[model samples]
Target: MSKIAVIAGSLYLWLSPGLTMGQRTSGLIGVPDTSFTVHSAYSKAKKTHPDIRIAAPALPPTVQANLNVVYCNQNGRDLHIDAFYPVNQSTNRNQLPAVLLIHGGGWRSGDRSQQIPMAQQLATNGYVAVTAEYRLSTEALYPAAVHDLKAAIRWLRTNAREYNIDPDRIAILGCSAGGQLAALLGTTGNRKELEGTSCHTEQSSAVQAIVDVDGVLAFIHPESGEGDDSRSTSAATYWFGASKTEKPKLWHEASALTYVDKSTPPILFLNSSVDRMHAGRDDMIGKLNALGIYSEVHTFADAPHPFWLFHPWFEPTVSYTVNFLNKVFSKK
Candidate 1:
């Protein structure tokens, strides 16, 4: 166990009591609601802190995390995976499963650090959680993010026993852009991507489950009403890299809904009313039902996207997520 991990774990446990009821339920209960406090804590702790807001508030033997663990170091640019897990043993389940997490920032500007509180809660609840980083749209687009996330999974699997993780039970969770990637991982299933280094190992990067928090499921949808705000055309243009009509075929293939086969992993979709991209989440849910995939969408009446990261506002959303996970994974 690293020193930083120990410190982070202690901090999370100490501050868990500060969370509101909703935050407590979700299991991610430590982030301060006030912007100033958050700003101060974030800056002071910075890369040294591990753990994200978490679920399973009652679970014990709390652990902290490290900001970035190098998975792929190449050309002076390192591809990292940040992790949160238990610091010591818990008799409930000595070894924890994993939630392979990714953050959201339109695939262009998000980092692994944002979800420390969430990851910590997941760890406390008997899960080894990782919030991974990959190349972004500005640096590289399309499959770059996919490949990096896939690589992170492979790394986790290879070292599962060391981390006390259940390799077969690893799941993927993402928010916003990250959620889109998680959806993609679910749709892609166990099939390996063609990119990345030829590491001479047959490790698998496919996920057993997915959690999509306000993701983009279909780039072009028949149900799309004119002038709807699922996204700005310019943002989509930058992301999709072609007009909807110009790249219709590619866009559909890339969408999570298009690839929702029977083998697709179970998905938990979290939607917020205020987000413009909520429609995409709905379309994905419809497809999940059509394909007989066990998918559930929890809609917040008017919650803003990703606001669950905050302490006060996120309490309920966090609880909802934990209960959903408990119900879904209990059978598996």
Candidate 2:
């Protein structure tokens, strides 16, 4: 019907033939109505929503309402993550699902600060939540980021007891570059090279679902029509130390869309109408649908690229994220 929808449908049509190793093409786009009016509605709702209020600061808060902080020194290099468990001061320390969160900053500059607050809120909501920090692109590239997240999952599993967490229920949450890392973990299962620097424990980083916050999907798909190359040298382009044209394979390998398999986790793509990178998220969703894998898309109104973190306290996204996680963890 529309440009974006047409592109999505066309891609679905191409992939409907199933997973065959070959080149498939679909060039269509539908521009849905994304207006500022919707954002105003969200902003208005945020003002009165009870959940919009952020819980106070905490070292590793047991509850978002209080101050309780904790950390882990598991992996070498003082590597660790912050956690928030139930603060009832009553229930056993073993009744919560753990969520591994990654922050986004162009794959080069984010910290757990982006996720800590939300994790703390989740912890308050009867789930054990963690905000982990991993090595950045400056230190490594391509699979390295994925490697670090896998290691974090392993560490959480190995120490689940001490942390009062449920390892099997762990899910990855991230935004932008962090979102890409989460999707990577969700799709790529156990690999020999990414073996987490451990011989004692074998923690499979297969998450139940992925929360992809405005993350890019395919690196190879250029816009169909004539346009400037804003896609070049993008937020994730140079991570491999290879030019876009020189390392075509590397580009595909790093793409989360390239690793979709039967074992890939159900994905929830949170997007906006203003950014092209995220605009292409529908492509990945279409691919997932063709494979019968679980996936959903939530397009934010009027928000532009680089705005997810702009208003960390923005109630609209916060509530939506919480609800999404709850559904992901539901028994149904």
Candidate 3:
């Protein structure tokens, strides 16, 4: 194993406590509602060495990065995607599965650069990974970001041959706000209403699978609780352009839970044990089960909402993600 993989494996063992021998043998480190009690230790360690930076592991020799390729032009703005893929490979008929990674910032702030490491890692593992930029709430409203993502997907399919990508095997992955968008994209596949006239109108915007990390499914549900209050207004209120009471239909329409059906793609949810962070997750999982669509949730014990971005948790997060994608794409 690589050095980072060894570190991550050791960290997982250290972080997991109270696990039965059977559970450990099964490699199920996450248990619902089990709080991770090591936050203070990490906090203290950080304070003692405040300048330390936890960089993501480097990609292997087989992977290569293609940065800032414009995928669409919307309202005169050119949206770009940073792609990563394997080089000089004869595996899988010289075509690899693709993943579109979206970053999280509550729809207000965040950039595609936030997901570069993740895209690189996925590429190192033999998939074509693209991190894309979309309009934020500061620039537009609910469907604009969604439209940009759909355009990205269409662009990937349109240029699959150039990138050695399997056009039909693309999946969507996102964190926090991006997670919400990924869920929406997965559920609203080919829905005419959400397919704004950005670009690539003739191509399909559907994804084959979804990976949501700490994203909200039902924005207006009471279980969602309060989110980052530092802003003058709630993120959802800004994104939807109105309070829930003022535009109930808009709220419902923007929710991923509102569109779930038998056609929805397989989904894998990686989340913190905090109930409010993953509000409506269980409800969506139940719906998927009822429809016989595959869905699973793995909750990290007491970890923070941004666990996927940092060390110790990042590796495990990617591990689960790759395993899930492998399972889903193999079935396809």
Clashes of each: 20, 10, 1
Q: All models: lDDT? A: 0.64, 0.61, 0.78
Q: Which runs in model 3 stand beyond 4 Å of their true positions?
A: 1-55, 89-92, 226-231
Q: Which scores higher on TM-score, 2 or 3? A: 3
In terms of lDDT, the best-performing candidate is 3
* Cα deviation of 215, candidate 1, in Å: 0.7
Q: Candidate 3, which ten residues in sequence have the lowest lDDT sum?
A: 19-28
lDDT of 1 by residue, 155-261 (tens): 88887766777777888888876877788876785565423552214678777778888777776775433123246544344444455565566567567877777
Ranking by TM-score: 3, 1, 2
Which residue pairs clash in candidate 3?
Answer: 36-302
After superposition, which runs of candidate 1 have C-alpha atoms over 4 Å from their true positions?
A: 1-61, 74-76, 90-93, 192-201, 222-233
Query: Model 3: per-residue lDDT, tens digit, 1-332?
Result: 89999986764554332222122112222222112212332464356445433546777788888898999987567889999888764345757899999988777667787788889889888889999998766555666788889999999889887888887899999998889889999899899988877687888999999999998898778788633335565767666656676666776787799999988999999997667867788899999999999987889886666667666677888999999999999987
What value does the lDDT take at residue 87 in candidate 3? 78
CA lDDT for candidate 1: 0.64
